[model samples]
Target: MYKCFLEIGFEAELSTHEDPELLELAHEMCNEDVATRHIACAELRDMIYERGECNPYRMDDVFLLRFLRARDFIVPKAHRLLVRWCNFRIQYPYLYEGVDLWALVKIKDAYEGTLLDRPDIGRLSIFRFGTWDTSEFPVEDLVKAGVLMFDIGIRQPKLQVLGGTLIVDLEGITLRHVATLTPTIAYQIVSLLGVTTPARLKSCHIINYSWILNTFFYLFKRFIPREFYDKIFFHGYDLKSLQKHIDLECLPPRYGGTCNSHAPFGLWLQKIKKYRTAEFDKEMKALGYLVKE
Candidate 1:
């Protein structure tokens, strides 16, 4: 058990309520066979390095384990998924390079949300999305902001191990906002969340969805894969229904939760900004990549 934790360099203590299936899977993949694990990790690393996907920053055992678990320990499938992730980062340098407080604030304002400190019962990180001023920024900026958040998320062992939960608050959304959901932007968002990113999506709750929003969502669904449709829950102004999936206590006051006197957007932003800024710089330096200022 300790060996498994050490192999992954997991500094955070495991949650008491961690899923048994995930724990069992981690143990089976990392702890069960030391020699076999090393051989397999070596093979995967060689494959990734040979393709120049991860050169200076090689994939370690713990990192490779994430790909393996994502693909149910299938080497070929995991390799393909891992390659996709690498390609996504390379293709979208703006999202990952030279991240700082200024960039984060812009992203936060563009998307109008933050990741809450407290997770759901399943230990998934909770992202609370507020009303976005769609007129303020381009659609691609919003997508880049979302991708940056996922980059921050995957750095955390707990979130990567368990997954993520999204709560989209559509209280102030207007027809203008809905109109921005073009097929091209919708495909980018769906593919980024579903295929490219390393974080697993546990659930997505869309609260306060208006009738007009439903039509937009219907059109938006066409871009996403059929399987992801099951993960999305549309709760139109039903706090009780939303609470069924996410505990009310974990939510902000605006969402009928008692966690804070008001929306804790500032708190979440400070936490993410403080923790991720330096790490993002280091990652860019490691990859010998830089973002154009």
Candidate 2:
């Protein structure tokens, strides 16, 4: 599958060869000093235990490291993030319950395809809001599936280290589609991506926007974090403008790039299934995911 499934969390040192740049990133952005990282992990663990409120959370070094890195190794912020994540779990357990990636993919409205190439930034996932049909697929189901993708993605060290990028193609957005994102749903999305998620969101590219999309953002922009807002780019149907941030080489021909073509949805499902190892399933189970045997 991937060179290695998510590495088992323990006392292992960072590998020099996997992605040497990550060591630099860890130190520079995460304030990670190899000597003191364990101290931070332990401190975060102690903070979680001391509060005695967050349930079904992992205190392992690697698990704690994800939150720490996302918050720049600030122990208190990391603890806060970890607690918010735990509360999100308790608050919306349905999001994690029995996520059938196979079934989710079949919902035409909720199509998510992986970009075949993994860029230095991280793995890329593209979503077409245009494909969503509110009449058939409930918005909550879309959120349920989206959360599963995030949960799976954050477990991988490569994604955790390099972070992830998203391309949102809003080619056919309409008032009907915009209506699906109510204020509460919009707030949850903003909070999940901007804060609660342990995964680092390197960037989000919004392309092929229309006035409807603009109006929706106007109404809900306040819900988004300022820093996260800065990372979002509105390309407005200009793939060339998008090219400035993401190399054309990484995009597909549909977006004016030189990738052969997108893989079939079923193909991506097969690949994702490879990631569901015994250990991975166990961790997800502890987090209340209904992992099918």
Candidate 3:
């Protein structure tokens, strides 16, 4: 059995030997000076409100800090990102509108994986993408499913603060599966995850990939931003290489780890369903009457 460590709120045991540049950047952005950070956060919040981009919600320090850190403390850029996020929701009402939990579960299970479970030791959420029944749902529905997952992640303080990882196991994926990833769909996926959302993508590991998959990914990479491009790691079935970056204890048994027995996908999905559904409900209710003024 895998040992489970309970973490509370946004706090986690992060690495002490962080990169100096990143350490410095964190200080410059939100850690070094408390009073200055507050001032900057408040200014950005006021700017967001004044522009009438989104409905009035509590722009707490933690919330503002996410945007600030995402844009490297550039208030205008962060504000723009925040506006784009809100606008995406407004434009894609069907995606964010009345969500059906069972539908989400269907999409998730159809892929033979789950994304709602616990984070790794690095305090990063892990998504295992196994065999997917592509015919079970349209690509748009799949994209919406992704949006829902990301929405939950961005809302969670721990995920927002620390970011997450994605492990795509292509063991069972075939050319037929690759066909579903059209250029348009690829662009939409990249835009939503890389550009719109506030969640930081720590790393994306594609394991058990084939040459055909690599070719497709090369095309997909063109649509993603350069910054995010660096985070993509191709293991090609090399679990040892992957473990070099991520702890073995954090992964499921299928991925050569000990944790799967402790926290199965079903249990994790249930917890996420319960929590995300309520959060989505609250957001929709809050913005229920909001009109694009």
Candidate 4:
């Protein structure tokens, strides 16, 4: 059926809910897979109960709301997906604990793609999200959520970018790389940050960036719309750095904004502790091909 939908362009939007990510959440209420179905639906329910503020970009809140018009706009699969996982937990309620959530993330060198949709450090800008005090605990689940960076054109996975190049840092050139130590590094850092996890990543988004204003604006003295850019298409880059990049739309961005503003570091463990859930899963099954540096 899904294959058929592909030919017909049957598109289904995902709500901000976390359950859909489980993949099994798509299983129908009547489908019979026993363990698979039970785990999928049950776990889906659990994720919802544990749900806090769903990322507006990832999942939609409206999907949970049944009948926006009282009779129309029913989202059963959504409702089921969002909360079924929780149903699995009624027997034993537990929260992720004792895992160091603040795992140091090393962005791997991108062999072929681009990175997009990563942490929103702008909000976390020391001013807004507040700085972390090791004495306090937070940001564990967020650590678990990892990141969603766009891989514009690169293809190879898992090569850590050693450091920014002379052009990328000084001239402000954008380079792509894979995260060298997602699972392995997570092992070390999570132990330090103190949060539990299968240590799996949340998701990955792919997009592009451009440096526009740096090329123009001073002459026009007038403003250009940022939407006017020519290269980047996917949304969510740092409003600060993205200004440097002009999407094909040619719109001008705020002077200080660009996608580079995306958070570079992990949140403090103190923040992750608040909504921690243990039943989610623990024990990182370490396995891999580490490109020896």
Candidate 5:
């Protein structure tokens, strides 16, 4: 490694500790990307099953609660769901094991109209259902399972408060960190993805936000990777704060702003597979997702 660094002419001497700066350079590296990302994950699993005990597998439902609880979680209600999720996995292992990892949870079905609805369920119910954005069990149909409080909701943030909550009016939504969306809906999005979830976004919309935040909180980590600097993305249209906050690489402010000023969004689809553009022509050949840094 030292010899390679010397050849590349990097001045900083290699050290035992790879602080955040050294570990995260906007450069491509080995077989490591979202599709492969799993350090904290492996650690957690090992912690759960003691590494050699049960293979310390990849991801299980419990990882969701562990991640969400790391930041104290959103509200008691969100925690309530998490509790049910945990117990459900234990009491009904075979039932939980049938989850299709690739599919999104039917947000309405996965969480709505179930034991989760009972205040009697509490955090335990969430544990039983799972802290996972998507429970191993998909939501049941109304015929099989009963439900109540069908249309519960939260208020959407007003356009005027965009700056406060950091909502952006996008020409289109691809991916960016700063969004003024009623962040509360995080959970709804999470349930659908059936994989990663996100943390609760602080917002004023109470009625509906809780449902969404609890749903999608895990996915947030996917957007904000180990590289914090790269995580800095904001609304391109908010010119007043553009100088103060968002730094668009291309588009300026307003309709006359810079073209192609889009912030990177969605799955980090830098590989050339789907986007056969001239730029990705070579990357696709590599068959790996690159760190755009």
Candidate 6:
């Protein structure tokens, strides 16, 4: 039913549904062949059990498929990712434990970070550090909110296959803000997304950056993988430079684009709420996260 994504350079029409064309694309790009996929999932489950992990992980095909796709269907690599992710959860309980889906309204209300209304090659999310008030909202709370966002966003199969893009707008970033991102926080943030998370990040656009933000990136640079490092583009307040990758019309008005109307972060959260399944709640509860009824 989705006709637009057939061409090579065409932007994918974002939908919760993954049509046949996307499946074919996954097979071509992500090595998701039909026959081997079943075997790979089974093997990954076995590998996890062999590790003698005490934590309860969702070992079903649906949950396991994300790691497999993230690592290009390599079972061993997928297995490693699963283990690292489980370990990451144990390492950082503050980010996950007692996190309430509704309680994050304050962070979303800040509108510091959100996905744009339109979809480019992948879903375009903007994180505006300029809007963040560190005094009111601790950097740790932002990290907690980010973890929640990732957990929710990763449930979409379309996002898993097509990947996503991030725009980190560093306008008005002060030294104080940079100070908040200490080496430990930097390492945790980098390791959480880069090392453990199964989500595919197509590219990261750094716009509205300054020397202060440069210091932060310098700290973040070491933890970034070489492959991921190549995907980082520094626009440094050049909207035109950003437009080269993201079309002018597709961008919101803040970034010098024609699209004026945009969905607020809370609205997007409401829309994605349906993607949260009973199984998700169970997993969260197992990890000592309180999922309110």
Candidate 3 structure quality by residue, lDDT tens digits, 1-293: 12333311211222122345544545643343444778888889889778887753558886677677666577898898888777667667677565553446565442222222343432334433444576766667766666765554455444444455666566766677777878767766776654877766677787887777775686578887787878888888789998887776666676787654332333444555443344455653554321121
- The per-candidate count of clashes, in order, stands at 0, 1, 1, 95, 52, 0
Residue 100 CA displacement from its true place in model 4, Å: 3.3
Count backbone overlaps in model 5.
52
lDDT of 5 by residue, 1-293 (tens): 74453322211111112234322320121112223335434444445454232221224533333333322332233233334444333433332243221122232222221111111111100001222132233333211111111100000011001101122232222222223222323323222121121222221111112233333334444433343323234433444544333223222233233332121211111211232343332222222222132
In TM-score terms, candidate 4 sits at: 0.22
Each model's lDDT comes to 0.57, 0.68, 0.59, 0.23, 0.25, 0.71
* Cα lDDT, model 4, residue 191: 26
RMSD of each: 7.0, 5.0, 6.5, 19.6, 18.4, 5.2
Task: Please list the residue runs of candidate 5 whose C-alpha ends up more than 4 Å from where it truly belongs after superposition.
Answer: 1-22, 26-42, 50-167, 170-186, 189-238, 250-293
Best by TM-score: 6
Model 4, 91-138: lDDT tens digits are 112222222323323211211111222112101111111122322433
Candidate 1 residue pairs in clash (backbone atoms < 3 Å): none
Residue pairs in collision within model 2: 208-237
234 Cα displacement, candidate 4 (Å): 4.9
- lDDT of each residue in 64-141, candidate 6, tens digit only: 888998899998888777878888887888897887766666665333332332234566667766677788778887
lDDT of 1 by residue, 55-148 (tens): 3244777667666655555676667778877776676666556544234455443343323333343233333333466666676667765665
TM-score per candidate, in order? Answer: 0.71, 0.83, 0.73, 0.22, 0.25, 0.84
Candidate 2, residue 59: how far the Cα is off, in Å: 1.3
Lowest lDDT 10-residue stretch of candidate 1: 7-16
State the lDDT at 147 in candidate 2. 79
Candidate with top lDDT is: 6
79 in model 3: Cα distance from truth in Å? 1.8
Poorest stretch of ten by lDDT in candidate 6:
5-14
lDDT of residue 245 for candidate 1 = 80
